[model samples]
Target: MQKNGFPLDELDFAILSCLQKDGRMSFTVIAEKLNVSIGTIRTRVNKLIEEGTINIIGRVNPAKVGFGAYAQIAIYVRPATLKDKVAQKIARLPEVSFLAMTSGDYDLEVDVMCRDNDHLVQFINEISKIEGVYQTKTTLYFKVYKYAQPDLNLLK
Candidate 1:
């Protein structure tokens, strides 16, 4: 593990890879595959979670769940100082599934999920009412080929 990078060893990478493939896989199964004890696997997984190295989560397909409107919105904030505040406000919105402070033409970007076109329009209208938000450009997703976290191979 490098000092400035994520503090993960080979075992940690292997554990993450296994979890990515099957988040519900038993620790015993992983241990058996890695030739480690169950207790060791448990301890290591706990440590990884404690250090914020990995998050075990159940993901759902938004489209299958009736959220058909998926859009990426770029928001331009009036004053640079208000960027964080606007992002926080946007992040609190239920429609916003993902939010990030960005360095580009836009100050912030958000991924929004809505039931349909009407819901999406309403959401965008609501966002336009935010005080510091000067402008917003929305790009609707026609299809999502992939939606998952970064591959564990990058850890190598």
Candidate 2:
């Protein structure tokens, strides 16, 4: 990678593509799949980590963890302040599983994990009370039949 974040090379992109799909895959496994030495895989993985090209993390299902009700809250900010600040507040809220800035009528979208509909309503009420928030729309999840799986070829 270049100092100013140059586009990744084939090797770097390939490594990222693999890890993005399965963060917990062993270095040896990756090396074999990519037809490279384990040492090379280890070194490249370390570089990717340092360069922020990849993040290896443990992901858990909120529903399986006793938070079955999920809500997607679309927030309309009065003037749209720094998302980082709002995200910090959302992160501190245990029920907030995911949050992101968007490019539409809503300034931010928050994924919340709730125990029930009451929990979801209470959380939305609390979020609406945050400073600078004008309005919010919530979408409740019914049945999520599928989970996200990254396609490595997109990066290629």
Candidate 3:
């Protein structure tokens, strides 16, 4: 399927690679790195925002955010209404951070951060009500060893 929102180009990808590493980096700094004018950097950043391809926000580490638990839930859906209404509801829930619909043993995978066991239980109970959802298997993450954005170096 053709995805909507910003159609990324090489320069846009370069800008994103830089900003993803440090969201607070200024336009002047990015312009220097990308060998583009400061004006160009500003335009690209604004376009990214307008197209909904980027949101410059402080992405809190779960530990710092007081999320005592992080879990992944795999959900199986009925054949009738796969990702339509069900995924929409999951996306709106406060605890849900990352959601992806996939073709495999599970129809969807949802990542959630919770304050505690009670919070996790509550989220699980509430999210099950999403239409067309049939079953779910959840796995808690104990130690987050590594999480990194792809380095642009390898793409060279």
Best by TM-score: 1
Better of 1 and 2 by lDDT: 1
Q: Return the TM-score for candidate 1, rounded to 2 decimals.
A: 0.94
lDDT of 1 at 28: 92
What are the lDDT figures for the candidates, one per model?
0.91, 0.80, 0.86
- The Cα RMSD in angstroms, rounded to one decimal, for candidate 3 relative to the true structure is 3.0
TM-scores of the models, in the given order? 0.94, 0.82, 0.83
Clashing pairs in model 1, backbone N/Cα/C closer than 3 A: none
lDDT of 1 by residue, 1-156 (tens): 742365778898899889989999999999999999999999999988888888998888999999989999999999889998888888999998899998979999999999998999999999999989999999999999999888868656
After superposition, the stretches of candidate 1 with alpha carbons farther than 4 Å from their true spots are: 3-6
**Model 2 Cα lDDT, one tens digit per residue, 4-64:** 4655677777777777778788999888988999999999888878877677888777778
Question: Candidate 2, residue 104: CA error in Å?
Answer: 2.9
6-96 in candidate 3: lDDT tens per residue? 4677888889888998999999999999999999999999988888877889777888769998999999989746677798889999999
The C-alpha RMSD of each candidate to the native structure, in angstroms, is 1.5, 2.7, 3.0
> In terms of TM-score, which candidate is stronger, 1 or 2?
1
